[model samples]
Target: MSEANIDIQLLDDVMNKTVVSVEESKEKIFEIAENAHKENNFITLELETLRNEIDLVITQTDELEWKAKQARQRLANISRGFKRYSELEIREAYEMASQMQIQLSLSRDKEKHLRERRDELERRHRNILNTIEKSENLISQMGIVLNYLQGDLRKVGIALESAHHHQLLGIQIIQAQEEERKRVARDIHDGPAQSMANVALRSEIVEKMLNQNRIDEAKVELRLLKELTRASLVDVRKIIFDLRPMALDDLGLTPTLRKYLEEYEKRHHIETKLTLLSPERRLQSSIEVAVFRLIQESLNNTAKHANAKQVEVKLEFKPNKVLFMVADNGIGFEKQAKGERPQFGIMGMQERVKLLQGTMKIESKPGKGTILFFGIPLRIEENTKAGGSEK
Candidate 1:
């Protein structure tokens, strides 16, 4: 029993066991198919996500490109600023150089003018120094030649003075000679002429008497009056000849002086003396005239102012000089007071002497005889420049 039943149970148990195995196999196959389907859906979702991520990446790239363009514009602006700054620096430097050149030219012109002024001042200084030196040399040489020359000049002056003094003596003698001639003429006209007229009247009377009837008396008287009249006519002719003698001009000064003196003494009945010392042959005409004029003035003064009875005349001629004097024993005047006007004769004589570049001296005392002395130079024209010479 047990075997058959036990075999059967064992088979059954084997069948059930096979059945459970088939079920498990089916569940596994279904599970595998479902898992495969879920896997496929997940793969499709992942593909869609990848497409969206690609779009986001495109937007970010566009933003980065825009930033790069802005950076390029900023660089261009910086370059332009640097270029403008360089141009301004160059223009300012050029203007500064031009101003320096103008200042240098003005300084050169001032230097040239200063140099010319300095040269002119130096020339004037040298000329002034030369003039001062020449003046000093002339003043240093004036002291050595004074005394000997002065003595010689004084001697010459004295000789001239003496000649001037003596010059008038000739004129005085001439004047005295003329006075004698005048006295003679007067005596003849007044005394002898009237006597002859009386004699002529008596002769006419005698002739009338003879005609009437007294012949003898008439003849005697007539003869005597005729003889006297003839004699007087002859004397008158002789006086005419004596009035201007040729010897006065031709024979020289001394002869004329002697002739004049003799005539003066005879006529005036006064004492007059003459003294002559030097020979006189020839002299300058002006000098001769000066001597004569001096003599004439002296005699005139004596005659007019000095009531003298006696006059002495002296003429002396010496080497380089001539002197003459007229001295009268007459009452003299007092010496003139200061500032007194000159007397006419004295002034005339002084002027004559001065004209010949000479001097005159007069000496007199009150109640004493008056003396006039004149001196002159014989050759004044030859030695000095006096006005009397015609040349």
Candidate 2:
């Protein structure tokens, strides 16, 4: 039942077999001490083995801590990588949006410019159309005028032919008169004028000799001949210059006029002034010639008819036109007096202007000076050059 009772019985049995004594008990105790020492030794060995196991566990725990830190660093790196990628995507998106906005602005600007250009072109087109309409109306009126003039001329021609046979005779008479004037002028220059120059040369030599008291009678002839030669040359030069102006052929309208006006001033003692703004640009050759002739005719009329002290001639450029104005303080015309001879100069000027489709205006009264205006409508040429596209 108990370890003590079992042990007493085992000892009593051992004693029956052999008498038990203190010496044996002592021996048994010694043996027990020896077994206890061995058991303690085994316990010490087990403790050392347990301590080694604990040290192994500690090393394992340290390895686990290191692995945990490495996992955290990897996670942080992944997160940062994600954040950087997101930032790059955002910047790219923003830049793309900015580029799109710039493109849109440029497109809008271009569209606005195109719209303005279109409007300007349309406005110009409308103006050109209006100008054309006005021109057509004016042309129609001119056509009526031309037709009326043609009819009047025909009626006048028939009446004159029937009633006035001497009309042709008068024309021939005027031509004969002109030819006679030319012949006289030519004869004066060739015959008497040349003879006078020869006489003048001889007179100069005779006069020089006479100054030395040689040939008194010959010196008297020489003096007379020299005076005659000078007078003849002056008269001949004046007449020839008036009849045929060399300046007219040599120079254009303005230059010829300048030289002619100078001569007019010297001859008539009239202060004729001129001012020109534009250089003489090239014109149709016929137009230039016609203009020159017209001015010449107008000036002749002024000199003959006008009792004016001063004359002002101005040529100016106008839009689609050119203006030539001759103003003078002179005896004015009486339009009411139909009996007076028509100023052939005025009528001729009007006819010439008509050929050019130009307008001529004459402003005059009893006291006031005559202002002859020759307004040339250069619109045809201007329109042609402009392609009729500018109003």
Candidate 3:
């Protein structure tokens, strides 16, 4: 056999083995997730039982307390009037008070024990739920890896040995793409798909109302269905826009950004300002997209974690590079603290800028705010080589 043929055979064999190993690991993780789910369910039931027991014990303790109080009052009265009561009655009253006190103490102890157990079980349940979530996430990530290995990685085997850095970058790109696809899928499922289902159900209800000669009820249902369908359309358009904003192509970067910021401010109720330091013009398509995404991610982070009420975005069109900045008056985070890395969103933004041969800087502190800066080169030839032109 030719050398090339032999190499191909070896590569195929290696890939097959790797795929099998990944599959086995995925199965094991799936089992762990399944077990964690079962444990979470069991803990939930135990928590319910413990709660009921604690309530019952509390009621019993309250009853014992009342009885003990009554017994103590009776004993005090009998001792004060010793000559009017028999010796047997006094002894009985004293014993009754002592017994009631003991019962109340025991009931309280049992209640305390049951409450402690319930608290422990609740903690365990939370831990188990976390475990289950982590396991499921791991399984999903493994599936992405497995798909990459089985499909795209196999095709890239010949180039792998030659372009090691390129291979790593390619993997990152693939993972990002997969993550984006998952986000789109989730948005559709939770938004438009659900709305459509509700619309269908409501349409049926409207039809029944019309058949029953309930004209007013039918009109109300029809109005609701129309509103739902309108909302569904809006959700779908938003998803499509997220995928690729047509405005970016038609109106160019600045206008697109202005419109986006307007909508974002309205939606998040955060005051946002956009300042253009240079003449408004378009950069390379790649640079424009990257800038938009970086800003979008920064804004999202601010909304999600910053607790900021106001944000400022600045853009400068330089002779050779475009400068972008986003600053927020939010509760910022420590940069590279003792053992923590930058958040994944920031890391991803940095990667995107790096891929475009750009520079990025982030400044943040605990009580202060955060500021991110990007300087992207406007080299036509290089950007075209990296990402195609607008046309």
The candidate that achieves the highest lDDT relative to the unseen native structure: 3
TM-score: model 3 vs. ground truth: 0.64
The deviation in Å at residue 112 for candidate 3 is 3.9
Q: So what's the TM-score on candidate 2?
A: 0.39
Query: Could you tell which candidate, 1 or 2, scores higher by lDDT?
Result: 2
Off by over 4 Å in 1: 1-246, 380-391
* lDDT score, candidate 2: 0.60
- Kindly give the stretch of ten consecutive residues in candidate 1 with the minimal lDDT sum: 139-148
Summarize candidate 1's per-residue lDDT along 108-189 as a digit string, tens digits.
4433443444344334434433433332222121111112122232243334556444445434443443444444555575
Ranking by lDDT: 3, 2, 1
Q: Give residue 178's lDDT in candidate 2 (0 to 100).
A: 41
Better-scoring candidate (TM-score), 1 or 2: 2
lDDT of 3 by residue, 154-271 (tens): 7665665656666677777777766667667768968996687677667766786788999998998888888999999999999998888888888888999999999999999999
**For model 2, how does the per-residue alpha-carbon lDDT over 188-222 read when each residue is reduced to its tens digit?**
74656556645645555576667877887775776
Model 1 root mean square deviation, Cα atoms: 78.6
Reference-based lDDT, each prediction = 0.57, 0.60, 0.84
